[model samples]
Target chain A: MTRVAQISCGTEYSGIQWLLSDIAERVGIELVYPEMALSRIDAACKEIGLRAESPSLNMMMARAVSTLADPTIKGALLLTCFKCSEGTIVKDTIRRYLSDRSDMPIISYSNVEKPKEIELYARLEALATLITRKALLMREKQEGITMGIDSGSSTTKVVVMKDDEIVGEGWLPTTDPLKSVDKGIEDALNGAGLKEKEVEAIGVTGHGRELVSKHVNADLNLEEVSVVAKGTALLSKRHKGDATVIDIGGMNNKLILTRDGIANSFSLGGICGGSSGRFLEVASHRLDVDISELGQLALKSTERHELQSYCMVFGIQSLVVSLASGVKREDVAAAACRSVANQVYENQIQEMEMRPPITFVGGVSLIEGVKKEFEEMLGVDIIVPPNSQYAGAVGIATLVSGI
Target chain B: MKILVYPPNSLILADLVERAGHEAVVLMREIGEHVRDAEIDAPPINVTEDDLKRALRYVSVEEPAGLKGRIGLLTPLLDKAEASVILSDAPPTYGCMGCAVADEFFKFLIRQRKIPTLEIKYEGKEKLEETVKGIMEFLVQLPKEGEISEKKG
Candidate 1:
């Protein structure tokens, strides 16, 4: 396992250290707490030359400086508790200090006691993928007959591609991951009118990638960010200088900044049903319409109502209030769509620069109400990549073929 | 009844807790007594190096001495707390306690103390009204007499 340096204070006390270790273990990476004698901490403190009030702050600066000085260290995790003013300053200073000097990739977190599982998985998995599969991430094209599966939280998706073109794809709402993967890959093969053994390689990505990949003995188990970028690049084929890829799935949302076919930076949204397709699912069900018809119903509404909170429960509370006041169903649908788009913007997009040639991929991108709202809010035409919803499966299929 | 408010010393959370007829056990109350004492030479910094060293029992020894110092100050308030009103994920500007490590440790220790704690995740702009209402409801619902009663046999 590749060792990633940990530069933070008090993760052990808050019990986040064990959770970090658990995530690192799950992702097949290791957390390296840079250490020396407690007495030598004074010297480490002196070497960094920081006079921060807390000894922990000083310790973090010392560890950060030492880690940056060491060239062999390929990755580091810089962290600070969100509530610490001094720690934020220290975190920013060291972050810039390291970013300027080191070639190593570093992930920063402003944390509380309970860490979000998906966020940790994405970040550590990104680090793990970068360290392990740099060449695959750099590969520009797909080769041979490869099958890729996205065993996501709410849905399982598979795409079978030959050379550079997709021959077949399968998508199903997820229940049991093992069963879903079994069915999805079979469906894709059936759609392509090909036997399962005909596939040259298999790659998997998403929340359920580990289990599914282990079951299949896959070629590549890549992270969502890299695969999504590759898939978006393949499908978009637009004027491809600097572009942003947005994929809002059933459980959470992702925004990736891309340069050519590769990811430069990415952010996954906080665990909120409001920022995801599940919110729309609930909205569509409550409105007594099929999920497929929600976009058309939203388009018919002349008036726009707003939902107050980005939490699904609170957003639904707002939705209920609007309905109680006898708001038209069309208007409520529009509000629900607009609320989802707004939350995605506020929670995810605002954190990253929205480069032009913004491609809206994933199942949510198919909703015209969402696409229209994204366009209206950003004041730019959003590109809905062809087979946008199949981006992940297609992406992994492309990546595994490169290997 | 004494209710501890996190940020360790937020006047706002303290005031709201007090409005529910409970004494607010905040750092300022403990530190007020520390500043008045003649034994500790450090005026503003109430906890001495030895005092900070003594605080090792609260958190791991691997932690820095400064965080230990901060935890030392909150110990008195923790001892007195019967219930707590903690607004989590608030910006550093909200409390300005300086040490983020100790900030987390304070919350962890309070939770370990097993008081009737109300931890509201802080959301600015959109959910302030609801959060305040949540705090009020939580404080009102806390057992007036003492710890929650055991079920009768």
Candidate 2:
């Protein structure tokens, strides 16, 4: 007889959690656990059978691991919900504990959607069980694969990987993410030359993932921030040490810290609607210039003026006044750069006491002036990865492969 | 050029001055904060001649705040012109006070034999303009010699 164990982070009446429980019941996987602390897993298991314990995450995942060691257990699954970062730590800890033993299969998942896609959920559960069962036959060895999709307000990305190698990557404007996500998935799938059925599991990450996932489902749904760290780890071949990802998109900013290929602490902005990329786009259109030329022009500025306006409307007026006064365009450019760099510095950098090498990601990261201004303002080197644009997609690919 | 002047507190009025192409100078920094604060509520506050003088000196003479010390600020500038217009975009009580102050100041200039041919028009709008026509239509009606003289005393 096969025993399958399911584990999940506690849900507080979220729609996704209810769907996970419903799907588990339909798939005939016993929903044997509730949200608990690390210490409780041992006691939960003593009532059933022996299980493994997670050293990092508290009692939430202890029962699943302890139970996985039983020869009678055929498969195991880990479940999590959205707005959940602690789940990553739990998954990482469990993976580390099960690194050597492959007797019974184990899988990890984050709830993607509700009951309608229960079959998709069942297939993934079955795949996880199959992988675990297959591993027991192999000569003690480990394999990894990952895939990442970063669906942002302005852009969408996809990356596919086989082990550590980046097989395929893509970055495109996020005009209509549903269509773009499909294209991204197709690109990554084709690059890997793996059919939908051949791929053992799928994972998704991003702001627009909820809508994007409707077009394509994943075995796991992860938060965008963790995925960025995962994607950057795979793409940061240019540097040697831990790197910070400064993701400046049309609407928000994220600062992620990665050390030795793991995300430690990360922070994100409150979507206040004003930042470098959006500002540059508006300024360039108003000045009737291409955005690409904005940075270079700002770099040439010699005169400097403080932009006194607190909002965009006021800023526009100030710019007009400066122009009337014949403030050198270079000075205006420098001021513009300073304005954007200052916003980033005040909101993102002030909180971090330690300065680390910064990596610029997202669409805005491509702008030369923003990067130059950030470096000039901080007095530190800014790192822009070659594949920075596709980091999220790459991270998704890494996740798909790693499991 | 058409202009709209909403001299809500007079700073806006000063901004309209340069755009209005008048020789009016708004001594910005010299203007006291209390006078501005008072102007926002009751008509011309308990401002003394000394306080007005102190306020006028530091104003961006050409900016909004420079038009302190009432009508005198407009006297020299009005005298130098062949024609000038003033617009008021406030309630009747406050607008009349501002208009009376300007009339008094214009007549004071005339008493000193500094009066110039000036036209003042008054109208109202939901927003202020900074153009000549807008100014002529919104706040000041054509200045009459009798009204101007009566306001001066």
How high is each candidate's interface RMSD, in Å?
Answer: 12.0, 32.1
Which residue segments of model 1 deviate by more than 4 Å?
A1-3, A25-69, A83-104, A116-119, A238-242, B1-153
DockQ of each: 0.04, 0.00
Per-residue alpha-carbon lDDT of candidate 1 for residues A1-403, written as tens digits (9 for 90 to 100): 8878888865543435556788888887878867644445566657655567665677777777678656556678877765556776677677556655654656667665456776787888887776677667767677999999999988999999988888888889899999998899889999988899999999999889889999999988888887888888988764256788999888878888766677655677755778899999998988899888998999998988887776788888888888889999989989999999998897667645588989998888888899999999999999997889888998899889987
Stretches of candidate 2 exceeding 4 Å from the true structure: A1-147, A161-169, A185-202, A238-243, B1-153
Query: How displaced is residue A133 in candidate 1, in Å?
Result: 1.0
Give the Cα error of residue A24 in candidate 1, in Å: 2.7
Error of 2 at A360 (Å): 2.1
lDDT of 2 by residue, A93-181 (tens): 55435533443344555432232363335334443334332322111111355566778777677766665666666666677888888
Q: Which candidate is the best by lDDT?
A: 1
